[model samples]
Target: MSRFFVNVYSIWAAFWFVFTFLLIFPFQFIFLQKEAWKPMAHRCNRVWAHLFFPLVGMPIRVRYEAGKPDPNQAYVFAANHFSYLDVASMMLIVDTYFAFLGKDVLKKAPLFGYMFSKLHIQVDRNDPKSRSKSLQRSYRALESGRSMVIYPEGGIRTSNPPQMHPSFKDGAFRMAIREQVPLIPISLLNNYQLLPDKKNMRLYPGSVKAVIHKPIETKGMTEADVENLRQQVFDIIQKTLDEYTANPKAHQNEFKRLTVI
Candidate 1:
């Protein structure tokens, strides 16, 4: 199919899927029912992927590393932020129940805002109150056996080999220490290929990979240990991504579909 037809189908599928989800699932209290929400949300991602990408012809290759951590254990999932699709990649790859620590502005988006508000940890980035509230939500999600996926870099990058900004904030690591959950650093490769940060966007089908680096045990670590753990994950993701840049085929299997253009 032509790119035009694929883009058209992507939009239609997204609209119909979100509309159908809302028609059946109530808008309110989506977070309250974590048990049902986790699996349902993952299924939503798969459905959307199959609908717009595979069916529409923008093949999505999602390469996930083998040996995922057990779902029974709650974890603090930290990932690099690139595209909106990162959330879906995480859900479809990671089997555990989790919620997102996303921007406060997402709560105001048209269709996704309401849904995102469900398990969403909206952060103001500037306001102390919003940060406090987001931290509280993160703590609660961890306590409830749901892992929290937080993007420590804050937002998307302006260039390739995106600088990670700085060491991660103490919030996620601190919570992991207090809650005694392991910190899992996840990396999403080529998610930006599907939806680049450029304006006037249309979703393209491509391979997306999420690398689940071995867990950094925060069991006995203190708040001061956050930076060290942060670097460990940063190094692993950075190094692996650099390697992928040299040889894209090494991680090609992550893409469930191949024909992106």
Candidate 2:
């Protein structure tokens, strides 16, 4: 059944890809040239996620508790990276546009790479120049009323016991402090369940939830504040995942009960 869904979803996704390319691609080019492209890109991402993976029949629903930073305000939105779907899921409720700090290697992918390139600040982790350039671009984006979404844990990790890459990078937090933007630490739970690290394969229908925590204000903060902020964000995500993994049913019911418009 899972394999069946994967096949069906794959075909539908192909059709949708071609359709979007034929219809929306030109507009995407236009939007890319605009100053307000970030939010527009995010809105497009949400629609693509819903329509692209049809085999994953489960709908993508995002519920969030409002934070201190207004959706209108720019932020450095950081989260743990788990799967490729993370980008799509993040775009659902985040009204503003955000630029992701992605590895340069992903730019080589075919059609998907084009979309990623438009929205990402490509960084060659091994090169100092690439890292410096990405930071500069991110700051400019923030100044332009756009947010930067970073996966502080570095790369995707898929395991029963999820472990963050040792020592979260301080670049993002440092930028937030310098720019005086709020640091929004998002916790994504069960996204990996929907689409685990399947090499050369796809996944079946399953729910993906991204819980957004309150933004951590960086007003008057400095480089000294980065570690504390990083640890706090890490703890929140770790604790949330621990709870969900322990009793998914209980947590899901509780989450639904608490979720109100």
Candidate 3:
């Protein structure tokens, strides 16, 4: 696609994103009014994502290598962070209700930020106190049977596409170990190409592909195993990402055989 069309499509996507959020804001606010209604607020978020993506010409396709997750179980979902699209794309991947451990900067994004602050756990990674508080909240969420979506790369620090940042944080692994929940590794195959992390924020119309690997059971694991567990999840996601990146045709073909949600 030409630069002109990319810019036009990006703008079109952005407009629908904001417009849909605004359209859903009233329902979100009402659903968020009580503690019990928060899950309904998350459902509102999923509805918003379902509306915005197709309206912007992007369809989400996910393949579960080990089969879909059990609805009754809670998991710690860790995925590579490459683009802004990862956040919304998550809503499409996991059907069960969960909270996101996102950067505190999301709390500054106009009207959306306010809702995010109330619904998700935001952390200032630079602040020790804030990080501690966020982790505590994450622990409580898991204790209450809700899952969490955490980017182990710690916020898109990678300069190269498909290649992850060198280090993975121990928070996600540690929390899963402590909570005795299964940890699921997810690979977002092509979000960076669809919407590159750039100043211009250009978006292309294409299918958003993701692979949900089998969950790694953490029951009976101790804190000493954090490093090994983190490395395991990282390797699983990185290998899938490298495979798909090397064979774009294979990636495209795989999605065609699977249903697009």
Which candidate, 1 or 2, has the higher TM-score?
Answer: 2
Q: Taking the candidates one at a time, how many backbone clashes does each contain?
A: 13, 2, 0
Report the error of model 3 at residue 238, Å: 0.7
> Each candidate: what lDDT?
0.68, 0.71, 0.91
Q: How accurate is candidate 2 locally (lDDT)?
A: 0.71
Instruction: State which candidate has the highest TM-score.
Output: 3
Off by over 4 Å in 2: 1-22, 34-42, 53-56, 67-69, 158-161, 251-261
C-alpha lDDT of residue 11 in model 2: 67
- Which window of ten consecutive residues has the lowest lDDT sum in model 1? 252-261
Instruction: Please report the TM-score between candidate 1 and the true structure.
Output: 0.79
Each candidate structure's TM-score, on Cα atoms with residue i matched to residue i, is: 0.79, 0.84, 0.96
Off by over 4 Å in 3: 251-261
| Model 2 Cα lDDT, one tens digit per residue, 1-261 | 667767777566557657755565565656666656645755666565555544335455444556334768899988878777677666554556678888988889875577678777899989999999999999999998888889887778535535555568888888899899988877777767666767754654666665677788899888888788888888877777777677676535423211111
**What is the per-residue lDDT of model 3 for residues 1-261, given as tens digits with 9 covering 90 to 100?**
799999888899889999999999999989887889999999999989888887887888887888889877889999999999999888878889899999999989987898899899999999999999999999999999999999999999999979999899999999999999999999999999998999878889888899988999999999999999999999999999999988866745445322233
Q: lDDT: which is higher, 2 or 3?
A: 3
Candidate 1: residue 1 lDDT (0-100):
51
